[model samples]
Target: MNTSKRLEQALKKLYTAFHHNKLNPECCKQCAVGNILDNTDNWKYLSDSHGALELNYIGKVHQALGRKFNGYTPLELLKIERVFLNACNYKLPLHYKNEKPKNPTDKDVLFNGLNEVVKFLCYLDNISNVMDYTKLFEFENDKPKYKLVFTN
Candidate 1:
């Protein structure tokens, strides 16, 4: 349960943005990587397009210098945005012709995007997926095997 400082901070920011209705997949300043970067749209410059995985010239320069924004590299930010948009059901690169949810700002849609982003973040840190609860449902001999515990 020991989470890295970067992961913990990113989760807190994402949680706050989700509940406050500030998380939006379309807006570069309100998307998943945006929220984690203190709602800045500068990360958009890292990639040639919104959901592109390749780094542009500026991004490549920053990556070469080992620069990190909010503890994530420029490439990492692009990947995070791609994961969020994909989970929200939007076609890659986010164009008008791409398929997207009927309501991009809907709470449920945003929740799904957040869930996937969280999984990706955990994957980057080599930690268990925090949103997973299947372990609590484990059963042996027809009895509950694991109990859900809440901690402060």
Candidate 2:
């Protein structure tokens, strides 16, 4: 299969996993993508402390990638955003009938945020096989948070 098709399939799997709540909440804290979703200290600045599944969240991902990866460029971020927006059906506040509606339910917010995070992680995995995100998730309280381990 082509790279784009592979990415779409992987993102669909990630979205399904998130819809099932298969990820540890704390994982979002350790991952660049998750940090963007949860508005963690590492990326909250990009969204003014607001965490949403909006396309704008990609900005945080772009910034994080630039800061962490020496040669990463905006072109890569643009591609990632294009894929993400497509997966989300281009959902944005502007698409809503009203200019501003009530806050989304907590479940909806979590679903959207986690879905975006999962998609971003999948994108990174596709681009570089160096990230081991499975090891980045922590579920048990007794276990320490997993550190990001980049192979190269």
lDDT of 1 by residue, 1-152 (tens): 98988999999999999999999899988999989999989988888888989999999999999999999999889899999999999998888898999999999999999999999999999999999988888999998898777889
Residue-by-residue lDDT tens digits, candidate 2, 1-152? 12454355545544554555543232333222332233234342344322243325555667656643222233333343333333333343223452321433234544554456455645565653322356456657877476553566
Q: Name the top TM-score candidate.
A: 1
Where is model 1 more than 4 Å wrong at Cα?
Answer: none
Tell me the deviation in Å of residue 6 in model 2.
20
Model 1, residue 9: what's the lDDT? Answer: 99
Lowest lDDT 10-mer window, candidate 2?
Answer: 23-32
Model 1 lDDT-worst window of ten: 142-151
